[model samples]
Each structure stands twice: as C-alpha cells, then as structure tokens.
Target: MKKTSLAGACLLALSLMMGSGAALAKTPPDQLIIGMNMNNLLTLDPAAMTGNEVVGIVVNLYDSLVELDANQLTNVKPALAKSWDISPDGKVLTFHLRDNVRFHSGNPLTAEDVVWSMRRILHLNLAQASVWKSYGFSKKNIDQQVSAPDAYTVQITLPKANDPQLVIYSLAALGNLGVLDSKTVQRHERDKDWGNHWLTTNEAGSGPFILETWQAKDVLRMKRNPDYWRGEAKMNRVVLRHFQESQTLRLMIEKGDLDIASNMAISDINALRKDPQLTVDAVQRGTMYYVAMSMKEAHFANPKVREAVRYLIDYQGINKALMPGYGVLHQRPIKAGMPSTLPDPGYTFDLARAKKLLAEAGYPDGFDTTLRVLSDQPYLNIAIAVQSTLMQAGINAKIITGTGNQVYGAMRERKFDILVGRGGSGMEPHPHSSLRALVYNPDNSDAAKLTNFQGWRTGFYDKQLNEMIDSALLERDAQKQIADYQAIQIRYDQLIPAMIPISQMVDSVVVRNEVQAYQPHPSATTFLRDVWKVDEGDKG
Candidate 1:
C-alpha cells in the first residue's frame, strides 16, 4: 500500500472503531501488513542492531549458515550450508555451502564470503563482536581460525576448548553473523568503517526478501525476491507501519487494515481474545524482565543496599496483576522449565524488611535515586509500581521515561542509577546463554568497554562468579555441568547481584485467522517466506 493509502486507511479504521462499528475493511491478500512500534529499531545493519525488533526484520533479509528449529530450539537445520560435520575431538567444524546461490547484489555466495563476514565481525569489535571474542575469536586470529578451503567449503577451528554446539547455535540464532557479500560491502565502505554507515539502512544478502525502502520510526517496505535460492515468498510485499499507540494497532487489526499486531497492551489483547476472528499467540521466550541497579552509585555499591532493593520489589504481585500477556513469575537467574534450572528462591515484597536493611546499610531514612524505563507499555507500568513500593520504604525513586535508545543507551554507558528492562541472550537452549548475557563480566575496567555485557553495564563483577560460568560452559560431562549451573545460581543470590529477575518474558502477537503458515519463532526469527492469507469466501 502507498503512504497516502495507509494514512487514509488509519483514519478510516479509527472512525469505524469509534463512530459506527460498520463492516470492517480488508487488505490485499498478496501483501502482509504488520503494526508495531519501531522505536527500538535504530539500524538494520545486523552486526550493530540491538533489539529483537530488528532481528525479526534482518532474518527475512539475510540467510545464515543454518536455522534452529522454531519449536525445538536445539535442533539445527541446513540453510546456505547444506551439510556440516564436526571433528572427532569437537574442535573443528566443516560446512559445505550450497551451489549457485547469489546475494541480492547478484554476486555469487561462496565460502569466501562466509569467512569474510566472520572476519568483519571481529575486525569491527562492535556489539555483535563481543560474543565471537568470548568464544576465543579475535581480530588478530579470525583470518586464520575461520578459513574457506574452497569455493564450496568453509571450516571454523575452535581457538579454545569450547563446546562446538554453542558456536553453531550462535551462528544460527544471533542474526548478526549472517553472511554478507564481501565485494558488495567493500564497495560501500566509508572511511574504512567497512560499510557500517551505508548498511545501517541498506542490506546486502541472499535472503527471501529485498528491502524496497525504510523510513526510521515510520514505515518499512520489502518485496519478495523472485529468484531466491530456496523459494519465492508467498506474499508479493511486506509492509510494516509504526503505531505508537497500542489502541491504534488494536483498532487497525479489528478493521482488517493490519494483518497482525505486536507489542499491544495486555488489556487490548484480552479484549481481542474473545473475538473469534483473531488468534493470539503467546510465545514464551527465554528472556526476562529485570530490575537492574548500577553498582557505580555509592548506595548500590553496598550489597546490603542491593538486598534492600530486592525486597522492595513486588515480584509475585507484579506477575499476578501487571504481567498477564507479558510474563510469568520467574525469580532465578537461569530461565525456568529447563532441565538444569532450579526452583524460584521465593523472594517476596516486604517493605519492613527493606526498611530494616536500608537502615543497616547506613541509610537510616533511605535515599533518593532515579529509575530509568522505556516509555512503552508494561515497562512504564512496572516502573510505576516499583516506584510506589520504593516510597513505602522511605526510598524516593524518581521515574524517568524515554525511548528504547535513550533508556538502554544510558544503561549501556553505566549512566543510570536503576533500570527496568527486558533482555538476555537466551535465544539458545543452553544455560550458558542467559548467564553470558546477564551475569558474565570478564573485565570491569572503564577502558575495557564491554558494553554488550549487561553485568558490565551495571558495574557488577565477581571473579568467582565469572570463573564458574566459564567453567560450566566448557564442561563435557552433562550431569556435572548441570550441577555447576545450579551452584552458580545459589552463589549469585548470596552475593546480592546488581540485577534482579522479576518475570520471564512472553511475547504476544495477534494475528487474523485467515493468515496461514505464520509461525512465530521462539528466537524472534519469524520467517515470512511461507506465509499466505485465505479469503473469507474460500473457507467453503
């Protein structure tokens, strides 16, 4: 749809929902329209993108070596690499590339491109490079460790004793390591930044869709790649429009202007659950909604103060009341329901205990602090509730709300006192995923610049905890590894870490029943290539 049409349609949908409740309008069956807030999407460049909103879009525009099963996350399936094999000692991986595949730039996809992409990640040392560096890949050794033996074969030799499956899962799920056409990116490089500036809004990949245009915080449009290697997309085009107001997205979905609605309020989602025309999918994810405190502040630097803040949180109450469509009661550092996860530690909302702890920490009358949160729904509501509770304990918390860029950017720079956000790199099924994201801090110096690690962002560090997490990852014994993980959680609780997990995240997406073959991936990599819509009259 054109911009003029979409604007007119938005006004019509609002009038229909508010004025007369007439028969709903319909969108073109050959196109897919999604309503969501684009505030979190800063860049389309996969290597520099931060949030899940960008990940969902990048996966459709680029193809990685493999894809993890949406239902069974650990199950790896082939994509550009038709087949792969691991060495007997599990130190080397060999991937055989598919033949005749071409990037959107018309350049042939080869093992050399795959190797160059991996090398580019380390060479840049941006947000995406942290994971590869943690796995022992570095700018100094990437060219040697990642090699393309032939046009059709690529090999990655582990630089350290690491679990090779973890590496494969990162390759499949991160979305940042998607192979880029080296020649295309090289030509677009600006001042030797390796095309970081141009690829911010443009793409160079061999995925199922080709980006037509993107206007930040407004709309993004992409069309199907007719000559895609695997198959063409079912829809001719995909249109994503930004709807800042959740009610607007709900109204558009009800009027058939939006084929799907994402990031809506819990109340709106519940009201639509009764509508037989819509189906609400609540995909339970591994990420968690957390309350993080910066240890850089003298008050929070005291472990007793961190423990006091923990008691000030109404975990059970928040999950019961404010977190219906958002999350469930989850308290441990590791995500619950996994085989290795431990039970909740049973932290409750006790204002008296919080007051007592605060008094003992030398703040007899509590203290003042600023709490940072995104202006989006759920986060703002959660922060409000937390602020109220903090006041009850004589702690005055001033709420400051902003866009995702402002809120997360402040946390990344260690410039905030308190933060309420949802994130952790738990896309993989392994326990190490969450630990590496939420609690792993290898270096805590000002010059280390480990902004990607949340623990480092909060100035939370413990050498013992870091060692345990690392030792558990490389442990070859299954039962032993689980025990090690369980021990790590216990130690984290005892230390009163800077971040507190309140609830596990659940992403709810509302879709019209007429849409078929639309499956929301647990890892946010929802593919649109196989999705199609059926007309109401065709049901017979």
Candidate 2:
C-alpha cells in the first residue's frame, strides 16, 4: 500500500466531507450565510411582518428605540434612543433620539420619523397594530398619544393608564416598532396605504444593514451599511438562503457552506450536535406550545367539556416524547423561569375523570372534533400524540394540518375547533407580555378582528381576567405586581381557559465553529452586526 502525503490526506478528508450531490460551496470569509426555512416570511415590512425569521432580518435593516440585551433580557439598552424618561404618572414616556443617526438613504433619523413610524402601525391596522391597539392606541387617538415634541424628542402619552416599563419593553423588544424613515416611506406611499405596499419589498431604516435583494422563498441578501451610526457590520454581506428541507441545511452546515442554520428538525439537530465543528444554541422563549379550543365551538363552550379535554391531554408524554429540543414541560400561561410564573398544576392523563366530565357535559359517547396544527415539525408530532390521547377519552379528533397561513388563518377567523400551536408575546421580559397575548381578550365580538391576540383568535374572553391583566400592569409596587401576576396565572387556570399551556418554547439554532459573537436573542431581534467569522480553512 502506498502511503499518501499529509497534505493529500487532508484533501481526501475534505473530499469526503463534501459527499456526493453536495456542491463545494464555500462561503466568503467576509460574508455570513445562513440556512433556514423562509416559508413563514410573508413580508419585509416591519409593521406587517410576523414570525421570528422576519424579526431578525428587520431589526438589522431598521433600528428600534431601544434593544433588549440578548444575555440580560431585563436590561433595555439604548439604540436609536440615546436616553429616555418616564413621567411620575407612568402614563408618559419621552425618548431622546441619537442625533447622529442616518437612514440608509442618507436621510436624518429624528423624532418625526419615530412618531410617524408608530402612528403608521395604528393607521394601517395591520398584523402589528393589534398590540398597540390593545394599549388603547387607535387611528383616532394615535396622533394625540404619540407626538414629536421636538426634532430630537418623541413623547408617547398613554391613551390609558398602564405600566410604562412594559410599554418601553414593547418598544425595545418587538422588532415591529423599528423606526422608519418617514420621508423615504412617504415618497413610496400610494392608495393611502402609508407605504405598506412599497415597504413590503423596500426598507427605510438607519441600522447596520441595507437590503440588497430579496426573492420570495429563495434568497435574501443584505449588504452592510458602511455609514451606520453604530459603526459597520462585521460582515460585508449576509445571505439568508431558504432551505425547506432540514437535510439540505444539515449538509450545507457540515460542508462549511453555511455559518448558521435555524428551524432544522430535532433529529437533524441532534445528529449535527455530534459534529465537532458545530454547536446547537438552544434559546428559551417566553412563548408556549399550547392546545387551544375555540369557545365559539358548541362542545368546547361548555366549561365541563373544556376541563375534560384538558384532562384528556397527555402532557408528560407529549413534552417528554415530542418536546425535547423544542421545549420543556411548562403548564402555565406565563413563560418558565420568570419570577411571576407559577409551577404546573400537575394535570395528568386521567381518562376516567375525562369520561365522567364528558358524560356530565352530555357528551357521554364523546364528540367529534378537528385539531388544527401547522404541518411543520414538533407541532404535527404534538397533534398526533394529542389525537391518540383524545381517542382514548372517547373524543374523536381529526388532525387537520396545513401551512402557517392556512392553519393560523383559520384560528384568526375563530373558525378552528382545536389548535396545537406556539404563540404569545414573549418579546418582552415581563409576565404581562404573555398573559396579554394568551388570556386578555378585551373584546369577544367577531367584528374586532384582533387576530394578533391568540386569545381573541380562540374566541376566549373573560372580563375579570382582562381587568386583572390591565391592573397588574399598572401596579407600581414590585411585590404587589408580582403577586398580581401570580394570581393572574392561578385565576387563568381556574377559569378553564380556552387555551391550555403544554410546553414553553425553546428555539435551537445550529452554528458553525468559526462564527463569533453570534448571540441568538430570545426576542428574535438578533442583530447580525456584531457577528463576525474566522476563516474555517485556518483550522489545524
């Protein structure tokens, strides 16, 4: 046998890594290539965008008033806002803008842009408008609520008495509140849309990146804004290539073609964890994976039926079997690890009790129902497991699966009987954030069309619960506020909620070894400006 030279052995190893059908795609040193699914990305407009994928991209394209620290979530750092002050009444917040900031179009970023950006959300009444609307801001009151005091100052006077801190957190954490260049956006305005149509493809921000090109479901590329007020992004270019197949992402990351991969299957993620050059970053989120029942449904409308259905769920089996890389066993509306979050109620799979309750609700033989869930991984798995348990309790539930639009759209219309999904506003590190999203339905009327709130989507509304959430947010005493949140969780559970918390969300992202400072934020406002890369070829 002939002995190969050391360099020849290295070459042989490289060839083996790039297996058959794998392109020898080497990402540039000054470029960061990320592989993930972009199917949920419907729009580039911050005000219209949903999903975590859009959050990360939009934050880089536009700067928010403040930013939540990826490591210290409670710490709100100044971004476009240099400093801020809350009035003694807690109903007013004044933000001082950074004078040196300039949009990618070379237009100065000012208080006018900040106020206009916020007003536009209420004016358009799009996906992002719901939360602000719930805060009492509307097209009629927005101008009075949000005002540009001066060129350098923006003041937001609450339309209602609320926690100023939560409002600040909302501004910081939700990427939708990204400051837009009013002048640039106005130029593109047509049909009185406030540039919603134009901004779906274009951007007017003063962040570290400038949108270069975006092809739906294919590729999105952004070049570093060299004149960024925060300096410049470490990478010259960032490429987000869509990979619907987790296997493709696995292959690309293994071959050093992609620096980061998100939304990969749990099996693929576990397999990739074995690779020495890759690390899986599991970030815990405040959102939850829940089983929701629409109160509008006749069967689910009965409190006895709702309680029986809750008992029918196999929480332990689902969390242990299906929620390993995805989430942990969390059975409360508030996210796990928060000071105010309560422990799980220890509800187990008791078919006898479920049957008894079902009989009491006049469904002795059980009733047929439909379970709506996204066709994506872990969700469908959870639904299948749920379907099995529901069958055991004599409840015949047919699993209905579709794309995000199809399933969530049905939920939005309050037409879903049951839903297995993950949601709740975990963007802020506050208990009210999740409760407001999951439990507080201000209006039960169908005409409200508050699809952004999961509680509204499920036709779940409790007048007392809504008041509790509102009052708790306004409580200035720390201990009393915490008590209020704890009480809220207990009350939500006792009320036989339309939504049952199954597991908290844990997002896993696979990253190559050479990527540096790639912090995955819980809020999803993951700024890529600080992310740099060392040459992978420099490895010994």
Candidate 3:
C-alpha cells in the first residue's frame, strides 16, 4: 500500500477499535485536544495564580458567583449565584446561591463555602488580595464584611460605598474568585495549612470539568464532570499539550492530530489565515503592553522626563511593522471597549518634542539609563524599537534582557530604572477596575506595599487621583459618575505615572474546521463547555 493509504487504513482500524470500546478508555472519540506553550504556568491555586496559562485551567475547574457572557464580553450573567441585590446605600450586597449545586468532591455548595473561600483569600494575602483590599476588606474586619446569614444567602458589607457592578465583576470567574469545597479542603488541611499545599496540585472546584492530572510544563488533562450542575460537556476529555516551539504546533494541527492551537507565531498565524481547513480568530483582549518607570530613580522622578518618554514612543511604526496581527495602538490606561474609556490623545512620535521636554527638565545633553525587558520575541523587538527612538533624543538607554520572572521580579522589587511590561486592571470592564489598581495609590509607604497594585509597586501616588477614584465609585448619579471617570483620565494625562500606554493586545487562536462555538474570553481564558466538534458525516 502507499504511505497515505497505509496511514488511512491504520486510522480506520483505530476508529473501529474505539467504537468497539477497546480504545475508548484511553482516548475517547469525543476528546478535544489543544496545543500551546505552557511555560508560564506557575501554580494551580487560584489564590496564587498570576499568569494566564493557569487561569485557563482554573476557569474550567472552578465556579464563580457571576461570569462574563461568552458571546458578549461586557455583559455579566449569573453563575453559581442565581440572584443578588444591593442596598440603597450601595454598601451592602446580598447573593442568593443556586440550589443543588455540588462541588467535584460531592459536597453541596453553600453560602458558608462562599464566605470561607473569600476569607481564605484575605488570610493568604495572595496575588488578588490587593483587589479585595481596594474595596476596604481586611483580615481584621473580614467577618463583618463577609457573612452567611443562612445556608443559601451570602451578604457582603463594604466599608465605603462602591459600584455594585464593579463588585460583581470582582466576583466573576476571570477575577479568580472561585468558591471552594470547604469541607473537603478542611478534611485535607494539615497543621493550619488550609489545604494550600494540597490545592497546588489538586482540584476543588464545581465547574464543567474535573482535574485529572497536571505535569509541569508537559501536559494538563481534565475529565468531564459527570454530575456537573451545568449539564454534561459535549466532549468527554480535554487535553492540553505543551509545545515550546510554534512550528511543532503548526505541524500537529496541520496533520489533524491537534484540534486547536492556542499560541502561534505571528508569521505562522498570518499564513494560517489563508488555509481552508483552519479557522483563525483575532479578538481584542483586556490587556495593555506598556513601559513602567520606577520613581526611585531620580532621573525618571522628573515629570518632564516622563512626558518626554511618552513622546519618544513610535506607536504607529511599531504597530505596523512589529505588532501586525498581534496588537493595535491604544494610548490610555483604560483599555478600549470598556465604558467610560477616554479617547486617545494621539501622542505621535516626535523627536523634537522629546528633546524640548528634556531640555526643560534640565537634561538637554540627555542622560544614561537602563531598560529591562523580557528575553523573548515581540517584547525584545519592542525594546529594540524603543532603543532606536531614544537615541534620537540623546537618551542612551541600555537594554537588559531576562525571563518573565526576572524582569517582573525587578519591577516588583523596585530594582529597575525602566521596565517594559504588560498588565491591566480591566478584568472587570469598568473604569474603576483599572484606575483603582493601576493609577490610584492612596498609601505610598513601604508598609503598604501592594505588589498587585502597579502604581504602588512603582511608588506613584497622587492624592487628587486617589480622591477622584473614591468619589467616582461612590457617586450614585449614573451620568455624573461617568463624567467623574472621564475627568480622571484627563488628570492622568497630566501626571505621567509609571506607565505610558503603547498597544492593546490582540490574541489569535486557530481551530480545525470541525470545531464550533469556540469563543475566546477577553481575558484570554478558554471556555470549552460550549465548544463541540462535528464529525465528517455530520457535516454532509
């Protein structure tokens, strides 16, 4: 037989065996396999997770009180909580839990479990603690803040008035506020560890899938939840195989061995769009890639120097050449596609303007500085572009390259002069969501150092900005609240904090022709429950 004929014969034989239940136990016919680069996965615990790779899995394994609509990014719908209400003062929120919802461990989910899960986040003080703290939640007052009046009723009382929609957004799945199986977790707790160590590699969620296995940097497997509250998944098993090189992913998908390619090179993605058998989708993500400067560096401390750096960015050049199919020019702290987002001021590349600003800041001769960047493609290329532009203004910037951890670690430690990084406070699709964490910093002391608050991390604080954030959240008038948020953006332009918005991320995912309803989240997390595959016969 010919090579192609022999391969076809073997595949037919395997399909026959799978139909006969001989191979069904190992690889089901309804399995959906995905390929991606998973080097960024650091932890499985939602409380400690900071990378998107882990969030992709966490969203599958856990349930949140509310979730973003799969088809519409801005709309919020009920998930575990069937209904909720807010008091007239906007300081109290009450959630009524859904009936008969059960966790993977077979324990019924309750209001007490929700309360415990939220308190656990505060006690651990993990990556998302700053989000809760921003709403005036603390370890000392957690009991008064979050309470379960009954088995199915959960109430949250905030210290100050806030936007109820913003609060609901914070409790959404993308926010990493997953409720846990408190009884099962307590059973496995060892010496007051709160099951933190066990949860690092285990599953305790109530979503459509259950964690089967996780091999660091190799593979993550999830089995369909037989008793899922949302009903059974169309696919029996979902497999995520890690591929460090995009070439391998391209070959596998081309050969019909992989169903989806989550991460691909820009060149390969552009080429894949031309293929008839593959479907490529590029969606706007709620993230921004920008440069952050540490105020501890005296040179960057000058407001004029910061403004000069903003003018130094060649946004149009970089987006056209380097960020094709990957990003678009977005020059605001609040990402586009959100309510109350300000229009771009159109700060184009002008070497003369940069030089003028430098001269006014008493640095006409320019000065030497260092810029830290991740030692990876796209970022490294962006840094190179920035280096070329700074040279025109006589600013000699030395590029220092390192891995994600090393570079972000330096930013977290306040050890870098200037760092190119990507982060956003737009997880909630609200202006306060980004403004409170990225630009507003009420306390600038070391004692209140919040790693999650990018503004606090870089020692950027403005009393007026902080007041504006608070006032906007508390304003009961809808139109006036939006106006206040718009005013905040104007003030942000005047105060050049640590960030200068460069581009908004545009994420692409390729899937085979058989896959349908594969909508990607704005946060880049995959939702597989709605995705289904059609056999060849079904297509005809």
Candidate with top lDDT is 1
RMSD each, Å: 3.1, 5.6, 5.6
Candidate 3 residue-wise lDDT, 403-460, digit = tens: 8779989887878898877886676778887776578777888787666778877888
Whole-model lDDT values for every prediction? 0.90, 0.90, 0.83
TM-score of each: 0.91, 0.92, 0.91
Total clashing pairs for each candidate: 0, 0, 0
Off by over 4 Å in 2: 1-25, 447-449, 536-540
By summed lDDT, the worst window of 10 consecutive residues in model 1 runs over 16-25
Off by more than 4 A, model 3: 1-29, 173-175
The per-residue C-alpha lDDT of model 2 at residue 414 equals 92
User: What does candidate 1 score in Cα RMSD to the true structure?
Assistant: 3.1
Please identify model 1 stretches exceeding 4 Å from their true place. Answer: 1-25, 403-406
